[model samples]
Target chain A: EAEVAQSPRYKITEKSQAVAFWCDPISGHATLYWYRQILGQGPELLVQFQDESVVDDSQLPKDRFSAERLKGVDSTLKIQPAELGDSAMYLCASSSRLSYNEQFFGPGTRLTVL
Target chain B: SQQGEEDPQALSIQEGENATMNCSYKTSINNLQWYRQNSGRGLVHLILIRSNEREKHSGRLRVTLDTSKKSSSLLITASRAADTASYFCATVSDRGSTLGRLYFGRGTQLTVWP
Candidate 1:
């Protein structure tokens, strides 16, 4: 079975540095999502995209975070001037449709900010 | 912020015993899903129950949903040490436009001792 792919399995950065995470959803999956999981907490949705268009980004910090899926195939999430609290596991997931469809998740990129 | 809330923040059981977890959400939803994650890893989708359905099963996993009560439950039978992980419940709201967006709950940690 095909799975979602993510890059930079682990990353360490200075508090003021920039960092980026990449994800490639399963082929033909039209819905992609970005989530942040704090230690011991549930994953929180950061953004959602549908066919290269952003559907929801209310929880994303626009001033410091930006995500794009230019061709709707692969996506990149960038954070400028990372904060200590920004350290967490960033997970990317994809689904074929909105309703009862199951989502496949990538082995997240663990970010550690010093 | 319309996320599901899981009960019994933590659970411990011996192998061969059954484990049960419950989840409650604040709003109407199109479907509810359950996922499992080992420490510091990505989520693995387990099962999904639609709002119009009452119960569904897959292998050793059983899920029950009550739309009127806005709650869901997951039962894992014949648990094993490998079943030790954090389980989360996520919901997709009825608002069709937010197709790819999922609101996840603070997961329940399950430890099945051998």
Candidate 2:
């Protein structure tokens, strides 16, 4: 079965450094999302893309965080000058073009900032 | 803002018993879905129930949705130790726009002891 793929299963970096995570959604999926999960808390949306165009990024910290899906199939999320609070699990998910369709998620990248 | 909330933040059950988790949401939704996540792994879609449907079943899992109450419940019968994980509920709004955006709840953590 096809599954969403992500890289850098674990990342450790110091504060003020830069870090990036990559995600490749299942083939033919039209919607992609990025979420962050703090320990003991539910995942929170960071950004969403629909076929290379950002549909919602209201919660993204624009000054230090950015995400892109140039070709609409794969995506990259970057954090410049990462902070201690940036230590969390980053998750990527994708879904087909159907209202209320189920989303498939990839194994997340756990980032630890020291 | 997150649209879904789940009750019983944590639960512990014995293997072979049944486990139930409840979730409530605050908006008109086209569908409600349940997902399972092992620690440090990605979420796995378990079931989805449409606004027009009241209940759905897949294997040992049964899900119920009440649109009028904006609530849903997931029941896992004959639970096993492998079922120990975090379960979340997500809601997709009926608004035609934002078609792929899903608001998730703070998941319920279930531990099935063998």
- In lDDT terms, which candidate is top? 1
* lDDT, residue B113, model 1: 97
Candidate 1 — which residues are off by over 4 angstroms? A98-100
lDDT of 1 at B74: 98
Report, to 2 decimal places, the DockQ of model 2: 0.71
Candidate 1 lDDT tens digits, B1-114: 579999989999999999999999998898899999998889999998888999999999999999988999999999999999999999988876466467899999999999
**lDDT for each residue of candidate 1 in A80-111, tens digit (9 for 90 to 100):** 98999999999999988643268789999999
| Per-model TM-score versus the true fold | 0.96, 0.95
Residue B60 error for model 2, in Å?
A: 0.7
